[model samples]
Target: MRTLETIIIGAGPCGIRTAIILKEAGVDVVVIEGAAPGGKINIAPRVDNYPGYKMISGPDLAAEFFSWLNDAGVEMIGDLVTSLTKEDDLFIVQCEHNTYKAKSVLIASGTKEKKLALPKEDKFFTRGISYCALCDGHFHKGQDVLVIGGGNTALKEAIFMADIAAHIYLIHRRNEFRGSNKYVKELNDLPNTTILTPYIPVELIGGDRLTGVKIQNVETKEERVLDVQGVFPLVGQIPNSTYVKIPGVLDQWGTIPVENKTKKTQVPGLFAGGDILPRDIRQIYLAEVDGKMAAKAILAYLEK
Candidate 1:
């Protein structure tokens, strides 16, 4: 087995970010990606909320991250981690190809996006439908858009789109919002964003690409037509920790639990960050921050 100081699972923003930091610190780090290196970030059409660029494509940003990893002298291995176990003082990471050993491990595999069961929703993903507003909002500048759900994430996406889109149609099945009052107020303040309550989406409209949505008022039994260029589904996030077993760590609504302040997990040598770990905010910048924090924690643990 190949030995290493740290092993990063998942090639998403968090894993990639952690690898860069460790490599720059002269720490031995190797990245193992289950799928392509881009992971979920590539599904986005465009991203504008990240610090540096006013607007940049999601794939382009991911590419830049990859470039940064290579420049930092980090090595990447394309393999899915099937199992993880502790052997003596080291951790055994098992993949289909081979087994690797590391002193510490960082879990950064973000969750997969939950989609509307509608047929066209999948076919038009990234083309007309999106899951991340910060990543896809710029592509819809000055265009009418529809936001699904009435939770915190939904309202957050609505507020983000209100700034870039000409108009927004906020649809929710219930007459209430599960999101905090502050966010609800912010989204409600947008003149261009119209909130539709007690409305259920029957199906996504359009054939080749998403053009609009079909919704029905669940309480009133009324239907309405809202024309839109894109539909953003911000229902919620499901974590990527189901397969791995580590005691003392809990998952809330399918998200891994961690110490909020330090992003440290219950396990001594294992840490988690980004969307997979429990966090209030799941933005790109915050995800990167979580990754940095986790890296620091790992460094500290290793030093001890």
Candidate 2:
């Protein structure tokens, strides 16, 4: 197996940032990513909060990050890490194609979206079902669409879809929204948007491509089906920590608990950062900060 001083289990903003820092510090490090390097950021339509860019598309920002990685001489590998284990004094990383040994490992693996898991949900995915409003909303322009959830993501996406889709039906399981009042008010003000409360998705209705969704009232047994060309589910997120074989490092929510300053986990040689951490704010710049912190901590760990 190949050997290295450190291995980063992702190639998203955090992992790439960490690798850049380590490589510039003359440390041996490589980043392994299962999918595209940008992680979930690739699906975002526009990012207005990140520093240095007043307004930029998610893909453009990701490209800039990739360029920075190349300038820093950091190496990235396109491979999925299946498992991570510790043996003797080295960490063993098992991937789909190869295995490697490292003195330390950083888990920057991000989170995945929570699904509705209703019947035929899998069959209609990408056909008429989607998780990102910005990614698939354009395809259904001038058409009717459905947005599910009461969180900020769902609200913001519903507002965005208002300009594109002819009509939008926003459904939430609770009568009140979990998002900020600003977002809720903005979504409510949209003339093309309709808010339905205290309802849960029951089933998907369509053949081949989805034509509608069936939802049930949470308190009552009342059910209704909305006719739309697309359905966007923006409920919540789940951490990608299944590959971590180490115990006691993961919390009840499957997120990693790290030191506030160092981003160090319970294990000495294993660290975690980015969206994998249990932070309320999941932003690009914050993830980059986690990477910088973890890199500094890993360097100290390697020196000892």
Q: Which residue segments of model 2 deviate by more than 4 Å?
A: 219-221
Total clashing residue pairs per candidate?
1, 0
Candidate 1, residues 120-233, lDDT tens digits: the string is 777899888988887788999999999998776677678778889999988888888887787788778878878888888787888788888889989878887778889988
Candidate 1: give the clashing pairs: 46-135
Worst 10 residues of 1 by lDDT: 243-252
Cα deviation at 258, candidate 1, in Å, is: 1.8
lDDT by residue for model 2 over 1-304, one digit each (tens)? 8999999998888999999999999999999999888788777766765888887877788888888888998888889899999898999999999999999999999998899878888999999999988778899999999999987778878888899999999999999988879888988888988999898889899999999988899999799999998999988899998988877989998999999899998888898999999988788889999999999999999999
* Error of model 1, residue 226, in angstroms: 8.8
lDDT of 2 at 304: 99
